[model samples]
Target: MPAIADRTDVYLERFNDALARFADEPTWLLERRKRAMERFLQLGVPSLKHEEYKYTDLSALADGQLLFATQLAGAEAALPSYAAGSSSDRATGAGPQVLGRIPRGARVQSLAEALRSQPDLVQRHLATIADCEDHALSAVNTAFFSDAVVITAERGAVLDEPIQLVFGDGPTGRLPRVLIVAGRNSAVQVVETYAGSGTYWRDAVTEIYAGQNARVDHYRAQVESLDAYHTGRLQASQERDSYVGSFSISFGAAVARNDIGTRLNGSGCECSLDGLYAVRGDQSVDHHTSIDHAMPHCNSHQLYKGVLDDRAKGVFNGKIFVRPDAQKTDAVQSNKNLLLSDESEVNTKPQLEIDANDVRCTHGATIGQLDSEAAFYLQSRGIGAGRARNLLTYAFAADALERIKFAPLREHFEALLLNRFASQES
Candidate 1:
């Protein structure tokens, strides 16, 4: 095992190459990029010794030589059309390839365009919500991300249609970024989908800001190739009387990690976090979430469920915090997992930290196999053993899926879940 300092030379070279392409950007942005790169160099890739990453290993990401997707030509061809036949506005790398009818009072554009046209707006909210200084992956993204998708809904605006951001695979490591801002009393839905083939890495960061009385529904679906590596982080901030719901559905990747963190900055705010992940074979998935109640009269709810088969591995860690000033805070969190095979493994931890004396917080975690009695009952009702097992597996995951309020998005995920189980039976 080499020292961590010895492993940063390759990333330093990549950062230098990235700076050359971003030379034409504004002085402020260029300076910020340089600072971020320096931060990454200071904090090399986390090793298994790191407490936060005890179960997952990222040695391949640190040691392997991967070309940045920005440097590769004709990489768009590798991206699959996951949103085919959908009536949603679409945006791809560096630009919006397919333009749909963007609702009135909403602005959607590429990060390059936003930086050039609305520099002040982009600068004010870009890295404000996400903590790039402390997290190494976020630092890498801030320093090396080629382009991003920026979505903004103005005050009192309501967008009934969803905004879809698609990231396709090419033969290169990719860093994708998304920023969404919802103004006071506004409402909007944003969906992010990742699909690709071949062996590569996708490191992504999404930041969302909801103003007073605003409503933002964010969804992410990761269906990359089984040979790929994926690491994603979602950071959200809510103001007084605001609402934000985040749903994550992951079914692909050789190894995947999903981190979600939200802060309730004002009173009378509500936050909901829900996720469902189904994995088979030797795939591994980890979900880590944190919800902070900084002000009084705030409420948060979290539920995460996983279905593992074969030799797949799953990890879930959820934490909720209530500050001393956060009186009248109400929080509830639960994690439940179902194992389809004896070889499958799960590690679950749910935590609650409350500094306030007048707060209600509860958390629990459960990991177990399917109910033998239930399976036998289904089998006795003329259903085959395999069919009965599949039905029970779907029922175990239905709770998290039902939390998705959008009809079309919910239906799409339902189909994906069914297809996944059907293929396993075949």
Candidate 2:
């Protein structure tokens, strides 16, 4: 963790290394990488002075304590093993499985593999959704990503099982990317899991494209180590009458920030964004989201909740935009926080910008402590105060948890939440 006085050289070296290693890639991809690198260098690291980053600062990241591995060794054995099947599989040594719970009809490939195999498809939609020119972190990922997970569903295909992607990293840090493409009228569910130990950084980005009338259920569960630093961005582009539901659940990292953006590009499209975050100790978690209605007759809904204990801090900022051409748009946004300790704190801001008079838009935020009356009611029913408090907290989180459609994934998160509550009580 040597502090480099000139961080620009370190980043430039990494960018150059990536270009050299991937020199055989398509010309279009190489040009894209060059553009991303130029934008990243120009944008640099965002400080608290930036309005979008006013609540979170990247001074520590810019100080060069993070290491980016130039050469990867023993990569196969370092892969992550998932908890497939039932909760019983969570036991030690369950063996590593690829494409866990993936249906037979669905296609999955690694970025390197996809570039060599499905170059046309990869080139068509690699950097379409993410706004790399305006976002520095996304630009950095676009320039330095070593590999990615690519999943695609063909036209009219329906997957019966959920697709799971488990990612792990060593101390050198990792930059992983993902692209999900669903064809016309297809439907599928995806679960992305992030877990690691020790002090490292995980910078991840995901781009999703939904064809006409397609449906996608996307979920991200982040459980990084308490000493780690994580920042991620998810961008989605949806077509006519398509539907996309995203669930972002976080319970890890000393400093974690997530940026989610979705554009309803066609008429009759629908998007739903839901998130739940529980943090304790000195952990800090921030979530910023934007939903854009670019066409007429589109709908979007967003709900995010946080439960903070000990000295943890949380931030939630959500915005919805309806363009002038996007008449008959309906959008809603809400952020709620519950504080279990006087030392804990939260900052929430919800905004709506509507350019169309025919649109229906609303946004609001709420931050408060537990209800004493409810606690008293549970105490009168012969329940201990501690147990009653746990019940109330779980109930608050359930509003967002129950939105998960996958049974196994939902059950797994429920168990983790229960264990977290138990630990906090003890």
Candidate 3:
């Protein structure tokens, strides 16, 4: 891998050349890609100095010394001998409803496949959401995006299952761009997961369109090899009376960064975001989120929790912006961190920017160690210290798990989390 001293423009040129290789693509979209490529050249990797990225530094990842999966691995071979403890099973939920939001009529279009079937739609929304505007890496994705999942839920439709995007670890450096569109008055859930035993740098970007009166549940889970690096952006928008519930649970990757934002453009809209990150060993995870309230009578809530140990580090930066016309907006943001070891560290901040006078918004953050008293109480009940700590941490994360509207899926998630606790303790 070339050192950071190499000009970023070199990578930009490579990306441009790759884009030129796609001739069948639309001209407008190609121009858009070129523009983003220019932007990427101007802005390479983000550091802690960026306002939204002040807590996370992605330079080491930009250097790209890490390995990447070049092809999807064997399916049966990826299966675990037993459930729960195995890497593959841990990345999946019990039963079929694990990602219970894709409706029967909705189509699943993978970019690799979309090129032959739904080329227009793919070009329309591919780089549209996280566009190449903010970060240079996003431009890299826009310039050279290949595989993506495209889903469309008709208006007034209610899906009973979550759309699942299973990424077979190809060779390292895999960037998957996924797009989802929910019609007006429709309700759906979509879950994007990263699993497999491959050591790869995973780059993902998702844009979800929640039409007027539509409701959506979005979940992004990362449970991959410890040698991997993950970074992604989730951008969503709401129409009049639309609703969105988004949760991101990350338990993998040596270095992972998540940047997600939702914009409420409709009156009477409700949006909620919940995130849970568990890091151990020398891993570092950072999550940054923003809820933009642009209309009146909108309500938004964000809650994030992190558990770190063994020199692991976690960072959370949540911001809620209520526009001037967004009076009557109700927004709340909170971030809680648990440090299991003296060497573990966490940086958390909850920010609220309110321009409306008649709005009710609050933000708070907390970072602390385990409750010694609670551990002792469990020990007094005959439970071992390790088990007691695991139980407490499980309880701490239970609320977030409970937010899942489906019962079977929720139970599966709980089991997954509990299994992690048990393994860490053991």
Candidate 4:
């Protein structure tokens, strides 16, 4: 058996050496990384018995299955969605690319490239969203971040196309981070796509800050291998009167988990989180989201949907916290699941923590099977079982896709959906 403590200590030591190789980061950023590494050492992986991770068993990862971060398995491997005969579309459907929008000015370069060309931008927002002291996952990512992408929208600019940040599967593990900052009055959309050739472990961290009066649209897509393991965390801080819209789709990993947190720190800020998770075979997927209202007059809404088949398992945990000063705040959260097989299962939890009596906050979660009546009706017509299931899956997921307004991206997602369904059917 692998010595968990010894292995983790040694990994941290090697990670330190790796940081020396990329020592060109700013002083403040480097110090922040140091702090995070300290925390990771302090709070090793939280136990499954922990209130937040109760349903999932992550001990296997700590048992040395996840400690050794390897390199990309096939250097020349293509994206799964882009693979010649593979089609796997989730809630957002399918598109030519994983993310629907990406413009030239939106910048999708590596961390080193950004450090050299756009130092100030990186300096302003890189490690701010996920402070070293706040989240352990962010700290872990900071200690191991191999490479990353940085996106920013200039003041007053509205980009129609969303940006895609992709990382492929490999022999080794991955630590990918993305930093997005929307200048005041600007509008932009960003898509993050994770797909690789073989089964691998992936840890993705994203930080987003929307300036006062800005509008930023975002989506995170995970379509890794059936044997792959994935963990992600998205942290956002919105300014006064700003708006942030986020969507996430999880369809592929053997074991996948996501942690998302949004903060409305300024009055009049608004946030919307829309997400979908689909599982099949022996896969398991989990999502945890939090919305914090810290100021007055802010608004937020969260909707998460899940589809499971075979022996797949799904989990959703959502929470909304309204602070004492956050009067007149409006928040709502809901989670819904569609179980397709007798062996499939799902666990969902939605909670609210309020300190302000004037705030309106509500949350709920539901687990159920697909509408059999609808499926039977489709079969009663000319549609076969597989096609009927596909049609109904599309219908169940269509609402989330409709949230996106980009015409070209929408069409691409539809075509992509057909391909994913085809692979599953085959």
Q: How many residue pairs clash (N, CA or C atoms closer than 3 angstroms) in each of the candidate models, in the order given? A: 1, 0, 18, 18
Ordered list by lDDT, greatest first: 1, 2, 4, 3
**Model 2 per-residue lDDT tens digits across residues 318-389:** 988899999999998889999999999998988678889998888888989999999899889887777778
Candidate 3 — which residues are off by over 4 angstroms? Answer: 1-5, 64-102, 112-124, 171-173, 406-409, 421-426
Better of 2 and 3 by TM-score: 2
**TM-scores for all predictions:** 0.92, 0.91, 0.87, 0.88
Off by over 4 Å in 1: 67-82, 86-100, 170-173, 423-426
Candidate 1 lDDT, 1-426, residue by residue in tens:
456667777778877877889887888777878888899888777777877788877777774354343232334433333365443545434532332457998888777777877788888888778877877878888888877788889999998877776666433227778899999999988877777666777888999999999999988878877877888999999999999999988888888988898999999999999998888999999988989999999999999989898999998989888999999999989889998899999998886788999988888888889899998999898877666777787788888889987676777767665655564452
Best by TM-score: 1
Candidate 3 to truth, TM: 0.87
lDDT of each: 0.81, 0.80, 0.73, 0.75
Candidate 3 lDDT by residue in tens digits, 1-426? 244437564565566567756676668767877887778666767767777666566666554444221343433223221122223222221111123333465656544455566676566566676767876667777776654566778767788766665554543226677778888888888876666564556777789888899999988777766866788788898888998899898888788988888889889999989988888999999888989999999988888888888999998988889899999999988888888899999988777788889999888888888899999999898887778887777788787777766554466666655666565353
Model 4 root mean square deviation, Cα atoms: 5.0
Highest lDDT, which number?
Answer: 1
Model 4 lDDT per residue over 335-370, tens place: 888787899999888878899999888877778776
Candidate 3, residue 95: Cα displacement in angstroms equals: 22
Candidate 1, TM-score vs. the true structure? Answer: 0.92
Clashing pairs in 1: 79-168
